[model samples]
Target chain A: MQLEIKNLTFAYNKKEGNIVDNFNLKVKKGEVVALVGASGSGKSTVLRLTAGLEIPDSGEISIAGQTVAGDHKFRAAEKREVGMVFQDYALFPHLSVEKNIVFGIDHLSKDKRKSRVKELLKLVNLEGFEKRYPHQLSGGQQQRIALARTLAPGPELLLLDEPFSNLDAELKDKIRRELNEIIKKVGVTTILVSHDREDAEFMQAREILMN
Target chain B: MQLLKTLKKASPGWFLLTAGIIILLLIPNLNIIINLFGEAGENWEHVRDYLLINYFQNSLILVLATGLLTAFLGAGLAWIIAAYNFPGRDFLSWGLILPLAIPPYIGAYVYQGMFSYTGPLQTFLRNNFQLQLSQQYFDFMNIRGAIFIYTIFLFPYVFLMTKAFLSRQSASLLESSRLLGKSDSTIFFKIILPLSRGAVVAGSSLVMMEVLNDYGVVKYFGISTFTTAIFKSWFGMGDLPTSVRLAVMAMLVIFVVLFIEKLLRGGRKYSYSTSNIRPVSRRKLEGGRKIMAQIFTYGVFFFGFLLPTAQLLYWSFLSRGGGLMETLHFAFTSFLTGGGAAVLILTGAVIIATTARMSSNFVSNLLARITILGYSIPGAVIAVGVLLFMLQLDGVLSFLQMGFGIEANVVLSSTLVMLIFAYAVRFMGIAFNSVNSGYEKIGESYFEASRTLGKGVTETFFKIDLPMLKPALMSGFLLVFIEIMKELPLTMILRPFNFDTLATKAFEYASDEMIYRAADLSLVLIFFSTAAIYLITHHRRRKK
Candidate 1:
């Protein structure tokens, strides 16, 4: 799987380009791509464009050789097969762990979905936490569940935006290493977004300085 | 003596303030309960048997339908505005909340006037298509009609909350969902709605409370809700005890609704670090879909704000030629009266709220919450309670003055003072809420820093707190002032003889089934309200 972004740009108020000048980036198959920059350097915007979460002013985004967005033609986020973990670990607070994991796999057989959730829970070291709500879990545990939930649908690529930022400084290092190890074990193409240089160095197989 | 000394060691000033607030809030409840008890609690049985059930069913139906409609319209529009690049998306973003300026009852009145047999819609059809009036033809004065009108005005709460929620959502979530091969609609149901559910519920609860408290709409439409029944029990049958009991029942229902909503929110806390994320942009609507959405949005706006305002403007002109001067004079006098009352309310609220924030006393904090309890009680119930308490006070005063031959007139019940007092009680909640919201942001460290630099408490308040509080103070003032202008139940009961605010004046015309003149007054109330809302939102935008 290759994620190719070309000439991507975005503006906040339509006139002021928060990120301007054409840009290009690519993440090769089974590689971790880290986007590290200051707040408004268009790093998150690049991720948004690739995920089909946002359309670009004039750019093309191809995921696995399919043009998802370009020339005013766009695909919706659900059709993109790219899993996302938000900065706040935006777990469905209302749903239990099992339900949250199974949420994206509606097209799968019920038994298959259940077994997949079980497998992913074990992979994320949350095998016995299926009945727990998002709020009931510790930040580290929540992040793991968020990762498992994102990967449940077998997305070829996973995009994590500051996934460990909410955890305490004591837990951040441990969680970061754990996150990197799990993604590698699953052999999914991963993009880790962070403002911290250390996090980028630690997590990425290949890194891009987004600013 | 030790306990007494300890009590005295606590700030006497703070104690007095808390006591005053407690007495002010508690007086009405004590009086109402005593009166009900004296009357053998007849009202309790009546409410339990008849009014309780009637109001329960009516309020439930109104709340459920309006909630569903508000959620759909608000979330649907928000999703489009946030996710797609669409023409008119900008226009819809702000224009959608304009209906919030028009109160539900006022909106209902305007719509009823427009759709009634002699209204423009019927008049046009009758004259052009040769249609005649019949009982089977059309009726816009029922439960269904109330739901429609309430939905139009209340949907804005949902719209604003949902829009804010969608805007603040991390863009990466949507992108990841798409990468996983989920369709647009699937993401909306599985992700967007679930994430924003709390906000939607918060907005829906607000709408539900408003529906529960609505009297003018239900009464006019002949839907026998508890609020109307309570009013009738007091004013029509002269059963104050019964009315108080009914009010308590209504409060119980509201408390249950609020509790259920809280339970569903499930103590989940969402935290976002102060960092920039790329915002999702608006999408374009094309062809028939675009036209359909425009019509729907504009149609709601036309009926909700424009139609009512235009009708009122036309009537204002007509009424000017036909004694509109008298109406204008009355309106001005009412504004002055209410404005004076508002100043008093704002002063009391600021003083208490500021003190509560400054003090370390737990009792003072408890007293502050007690003071805001009057907010939960409806205006009519508070008026009744105040009247009874004042009447009792007069009796005691006369008894004490019997030797001097002094006569008593129950001065508190029949003067401008009492009206202002009731206004303060009814609207102090808004003032407290705004002031509290503003105060919470001013860190205690700032206060400590100021104090260590040799600033006194008063000096700190005047120099540091007051300037920071200007926006919230202004907002609180405007809310109380607008609410006073729109108040009907309390004003109708407590206002000195021959006095009328814009709300009561409008209600007079509306009660006569003459909506044209009332439309003018309703529009005036809405204009003032919209200006206040605009100022608050503008201030917020500036701060952002």
Candidate 2:
């Protein structure tokens, strides 16, 4: 599915200048795009807009020829076949790794849901880690679980907002390459946001400078 | 199969917590809607109007007085500590939290005990100066007195919160403003005060709620607050409808205060842009300013700490020859009951907080908020709600047994169940706040890690999360326990018939102008409260 946006302008507060000015972008099917900018440049805002987590002031967001967002138009994140892994990885702290990964699989059939969870766990290399709590895992493991959870529903597109941001420097580079390989193997259309030029290079995606 | 797999994978503790919360939200609540919103049918308007006029006015006045006094004392002292270095500043930084230990009613007893006619302060005056009876002394057995005492203890809520805010004050902004020819006082007004308004409002709103909840002080002082009025209308006038009307009105007042607090916060979440938290540079006091700083800090401590303790000590000596053992016995018994209630409340708080975290559903979040609504309602209102809820339970049981010979009765209402329920309803927020703060520290990935390892939600909560939350659990329990020890109004109205806790014991003596007799128990209460505060602060320091 092709994702397209036209003339997006958004401001956090009207009194403040626009964080995401009259911006534009387009992405082809199954393409990976890396959004890069300094803090407050609205790199994350663009990711939120694509995931239907936010609405642009006066812009058209069309996915596969259906206008998802524009003036007085919208679709929710859950319904847009898009999944997000937050920077801090907003996992449900109360759920186990398996339950967290399978959280979005509520729409799947019972057999299918179990099968999908098993597959995603294996894909994230968390095969024997299902019973461990988030605190039990290292930062890298948590990132993978976050990725697994976000990808469990088999979203048409995956959005990772600085997924490696919280990891230590020694681990960030390794995890970035590992995550990129997994996403490519899964063949999910993805947008990876990063401030580190090295991260963008490792992801091997076309760059979309937010500012 | 999916349910089983999910259960197998979820932590058992989380599962149990979820089940427990679901049950709590469902079972107790089926009746709250009826109790709070049941049609009076005939007396609705009468109740509403009385609530509108008398109860509303009393609650509003008390809130306003308490809020202003607390803010003035709280913020005033906070500024003193933040801006100027003084001899007592270091001591007062932690010492100020001591007043929070003494329940308002207990503070009232000490205040009334020392200053009341024929008491130590007045008695000493009369004897030393040879004054005639009723010649030259002031009385604190009224609303104004309650306000004075409440401000002393409640101000710390404002003071500490504002101090934390002031600690994060932009030094560069103040420095730049000073360079631009603004005076220190001018900079304080334009920069410091405006920035700290949110903290001040939040802290004062809490003080207002505590004022509303207090029944012991107002009742002993013969003050006619909405809380006391509710009690009078319910037990005194034997009119539940009128009492409920008053309660509904009191609830409205609380609602407005809460709404205003929320509005003050707006959508702005305040935190320092950077965490390089250097303490505000202390200014050197000169001339009378140095004396003023010493005097102000000492004065606050004098009224807030020393005077009350002195009164309690003097009274203890007076009571030394009379029923001292009995007072000790009563104090021990009350401590046990308060501890029991604290444990129950903390457990419920942990359950609720954990459940809200797990589901992260809108409903759970709203329910958690609703439970905390009791924080704003006065203790008497909670007592009335508990009473009405129990009364209805008895009524329902009696109705069900008409055909048979069995009597369905209000077993929970008249026993420890009522006390526990009331305590939980009243102070569960303390547990929730403390535990939630710690719970937030445990990242979501930890839970996910456990889940993928084949643990269920319930198992993770107990095996993983609960262990990590040990400090929070202990601190939360300590806080709620101390609060329960100091709780007066709810204990007064809701304790099993004839039960005399330390709070009530002191109130009983203070009621008859026998401050010395009440002093022994008051001191014990103070001792526990001070220890609790010290423990909490010490734990917090260790954490830092």
Candidate 3:
């Protein structure tokens, strides 16, 4: 398994009780799974826990045989080879397209980083748009760039939190197909959260519904 | 396998540094509260019996009067400018803010000078108008005079806050009221006043804080406030313990009033952003109404900003005998101190605010809030606390001087360091608020985004957060610097022998009755303050 979680329970405040209670999941390499649920169903919380953006209360999270969280072991978010695309895209407004994509892969040489940016931008249908800022791009373009940036680092696991929520209905249908195609081409284990069951079906993802 | 345990931020370095800085800032302030229960000095009984009740009563009257008056004056102007449009309304909207540039102490000086028998007003009355008003009627050296000075200079705070609230108000509410055939006065009293109560209270509390924190106006006017009493105990009587005791009392009073204000506010923060908002349409005032509105605003602008400024410039040019070298040196000293202290303050603010943003724990959030404690209390209180703390520190490190055989005062002259420490204690909240607003705007998403991209906290701060926080940081630093530039009580007390910032220099001259000589430095202070006001307005307008 590329990623694993067991007995995950978490709460924002102790008095509020568990938001995600006794949750469990395992994903094999290159598999795509969707956690489908309504709002406050802890779909995003589970993804966040796997990405090391949050710590679970009584659970273990292992990434590629390394215990990244829980079980008296924790790796910082920076060290976790897990990438996430926030609902708002969370693009650094200050950085250009090229810089935002290259931000994750700082260890690579300049030429390699440039080529990677070119390859990813072309993959995301954003070729020759490297010099433009995030604000200059439309919503679809920004989401594509966010995907490109996350994929540029080539993480072992990818987490998407309501990635298609910000799009219009028309854009959502089109981008959903493109995003799934791109995720398949990259061939990385992916966990995406969406409230709509149709998104899971359209992406051909194995759906796990949560209340 | 190991037992599951709580996992927090990976690197504890920044969090620890933030905690350490907060504790360092707390030492002087907490020292005063700690001493409140300690054995009192010999003079405590006498001060408590003779002057304590008077000080408490006078301070209550002064803060309450200033708070109420400024609220009425400021909120009234805000309503007029926000709701009605008359000729010169455009300029007056921004012009009314100019009075804040003139410190209340400087305002006190100018008003007192204007009302004196030798001042221009009386002299003009006697020489040309053949009207010799009684001295008693014209005398402005009393508590009434202090209140007047506070009202003129401090009303801008309420004006700015209320105007901001009103300008962003929805047009629907007013339009609906108009559709219902309510009169203008009915809308103002029934709707606008009720809605603006929170902002007015917020603004007036700020006015009250200034009133409590003030040493300059009270000291010059010989009014008996907690600030003046602190100064007398510490400087006049050379009683540090009694001064600290008095400061603790003032702190308690401020805390209680602030508590009531917080409760009254009901934790409701007004953020009209996100939703589309149509600002209230301005009604055109005509005929008698227009003339009256114009007269009122112009009168405020004249007394509050123009009259004092023109006088200062006139006096500055008249008494230009202070040597160029001496003036330049003091100017150099003022800028250096202010700029240096501002830089230090902003650095601490950034660290504290950043850590607070990153951490989710309750303790870190509480510690972050504690940094603002200095700004809530008076400068005199902080100075007394810092002085006593420094004396204890000097005693602790007196071992460093055991072998030198040099004089204690000369060898241990850590005055500049103490001054900076005191400044960080006093103005940390101002800078923290500025930087924290920036943090709140951009939020932790960027921080988390950078971290997932393999950057550490420090690297992400420099690469991601710092770039985004530039405008906020620059304005915060500048505001803090300007504050330090005009600060009187702290600089006057804690400044080393022969050292003079712009504030202390002007104060020294004024104390010696060289009002004209004082004008040189006063004008200098006002010049910077005016520029700052312009920049702040420009920044806010651009942001809008």
Taken in order, the candidates have interface RMSDs of: 27.4, 12.8, 3.2
Instruction: Write model 3 residue lDDT over B117-142, tens digit each, in one string.
Output: 99999999999999899998778788
lDDT by residue for model 1 (B39-146), tens: 545556756765677778887788778877877877876776677655666666777778888867777777777778777878988999997778443687887888
TM-score of each: 0.66, 0.72, 0.94
Compared with the real two-chain complex, what DockQ does model 1 have? Answer: 0.01
Ranking by DockQ: 3, 2, 1
True contacts kept of each: 0.00, 0.00, 0.56
- Who is ahead in TM-score, 2 or 3? 3
- Model 2 alpha-carbon drift over 4 Å, by segment: A1-194, A200-211, B1-58, B131-137, B259-287, B359-365, B395-410, B449-455
Sort every candidate by TM-score, greatest first. Answer: 3, 2, 1
lDDT (tens digit, per residue) of candidate 2 on B357-469: 65424545675676666676777777777776776676777777765777554356778787778777778777888888778877564554344333455666776688778
**Per model, how many backbone clashes are there?**
19, 47, 0
Q: Write the per-residue lDDT of candidate 3 for residues A75-96, one digit (tens) a residue.
A: 8788998898888888999999
Better of 2 and 3 by lDDT: 3
DockQ, structure candidate 2: 0.05
Model 3: residues with Cα > 4 Å off, grouped in runs: B1-10, B266-284, B320-324, B400-414
Candidate 1 is graded, for docking, as incorrect
Error of 3 at A135 (Å): 1.9
